[model samples]
Target: MSKTVVAVFSSRGRAEQAVSSLREAGFNKEISIAAKGEDHKGGRGNTDYFGATMAADAGDGLSDGVAAGGLLGGLAGLAVGAGALVVPGIGPLIAAGPIAGMLSGAATGGIAGGLVDWGIPEAEGRQYEEDVKQGRILVSVQASDNKADEAASILKSQGADRVKTH
Candidate 1:
């Protein structure tokens, strides 16, 4: 069986560090990240995290495509499908990996709804959503039962808050 481990970070740097650590730990896939877009400041801008224009439709939102070469810091050059999504009530957000697609399709339901689909309890999902709205970053890793604890540990060692595996 496989399990999903999720955590929230108070800073983008910490989230990126967790991601890097996960990658170093042999987790090259099934990693997801979501953060309040750099342009999410009072919903006042058109640019995304990498300065890509936000699209009206979810299908086109990922127009930026592969983000391995665009992101900076610890997340730089990490091969993953990424883009900007305009979420209802949450404004614009920069999302990458599997959760990015979920957030795109979620629309009115937002992040919490997507997390529920990932097996996260509704109330916990809502709390995570609230944390993101408060400007934290969310990171999740889907791993086999044998590796679930390791994934969670990597995230926790990187300073992840509320690290939970479900």
Candidate 2:
């Protein structure tokens, strides 16, 4: 697996820029973006999220043809496969790309849960979720350890907050 780098931004615009910069910097791996449930332009009740009801499951692989919500509509250009979703800890959220695709199989938890699965601390994952709840946009990418440092630097220069690596 590749080293992972996460960058949080106060706005979707900045997050998008970071994605672009990371892409430009040759960190062309899977990039995932997530935003608050309220930041999107539509309702959570809509049939746009990847819907799979589960009483409990750690995480499953994604199945295709799931409903992607309005939260992902605007992020389509930036995040590879943007979609709106609801995980356990995180209420309603917008997500994009392979990370979200992997989450397409998740049922028991939210973004925080996914972060935990990826080795991020539980407390830090929760904090990341809270940041999203506050209208921050999150961008995550997997690269070589050295490249992750470069990605973090790129995000910092682009005004990314909460730059983290794992």
Candidate 3:
């Protein structure tokens, strides 16, 4: 069986490092990240927010264009499908990998509701949502039961707070 491991980071830098370590440890595909987006409006009407924010391999930081909106550093490139979107009560959010899809469809539900689909308890999901709103970062890994511990360890080592598995 698979389990979802979630961790919260105080800063995006730490979150990026955690994700890089996870990728290096071979958790590439199942990892996802969600962070409070820049305090600006998302894509205009009909604009492709998801496609337009593809993270590029721009050395240490995001490429000029992607940085203006999406993730920072190579972390952007590390994510499979990065994008920006607006959730009803959560404002704009920058998300990548599997979570982006969930947020895209969570317009009415917000990040907490989207997390429930990942098997996180609703109360915990709400707490995570509040964390992001307060400028923290959320990193999650969907791994086999046997690998969940390792993933959690990686996250904890990279300075994650409130690391938990569900």
lDDT of 3 by residue, 1-166 (tens): 9999999988767888899999999998799988765543345322222234432322211122244453333554568877666666765566788887777776578888989898888999999999988888889999999999999999999999879999
Clashing pairs in 3: none
Compose the digit string of candidate 2's lDDT tens values, residues 8-87.
88866677778888778775546888765442223333332223221122123332222332223444457577655556
Name the top TM-score candidate: 1
TM-score of 1: 0.82
Candidate 2, after superposition: displacement of residue 145 in Å?
1.5
Q: How high is the CA lDDT of each candidate model?
A: 0.74, 0.64, 0.74
TM-score of each: 0.82, 0.74, 0.80
Give the distance in Å from residue 113's predicted Cα in candidate 2 to where it truly belongs: 1.3
For candidate 1, write residues 3-122 as lDDT tens digits.
Answer: 999999987678877888888889876898877765523222344554544433333244433233333223423527666666777776777788888887775798899999889999
Rank order by TM-score, top first? 1, 3, 2
Whole-model alpha-carbon lDDT for candidate 1: 0.74
What is the C-alpha local distance difference test score of candidate 3? Answer: 0.74
Query: Residue 166 CA error for candidate 2 (Å)?
Result: 1.4
